[model samples]
Target: MNKIIFFAQTRELVGVDKLELAVDQMAISQLLEQLSLRGNKWSLALKEKTVLCAVNQTLVNYDYIIQEDDEIAFFPPVTGG
Candidate 1:
């Protein structure tokens, strides 16, 4: 199982602070697909055209491999100067 966190608007959309899922060794994209199936909240939340993901506080691309108990967070893109 791994611990996943969704931040900002993503957190509000999911309606939960965190989630724990038992999954085989999988990539971040696989994780997202699994999460999108969790329920209406997740499904609706990810309907946006784009969303950003990070692993353990470090920004990562979709291909990142996750291991047991890893912390992943999904959030919308940010822009600042």
Candidate 2:
């Protein structure tokens, strides 16, 4: 299972900080697409927002391949106070 984490507003919108998904070999874009299909909120949060993604604590693009045991995090760009 791959781990997915949501941060900041993403977390509040999704109502969860983390979730585990069982998936086959696929790219991050594909995973986002799959997650978007879960519901309107999920679709809007994932598909309609310009959020950033990281894999295994390393920033990556949407094309990055997600592997088993990988940790994925999503959040919007950070701003200073």
- Which has the greatest lDDT? 2
Model 1 misplacement above 4 A: 47-49, 79-81
Give lDDT per model, in order: 0.78, 0.82
Report model 1's TM-score to 2 decimal places. Answer: 0.80
TM-score of each: 0.80, 0.87
Residue 36 in model 2: shift from native, Å? 0.7
Top TM-score hit: 2
Task: Give the range where candidate 1 is weakest over 10 consecutive residues by summed lDDT.
Answer: 43-52
lDDT of 1 by residue, 1-81 (tens): 777888788889889878777654788788778788989889777653467887778988888888777788788887668
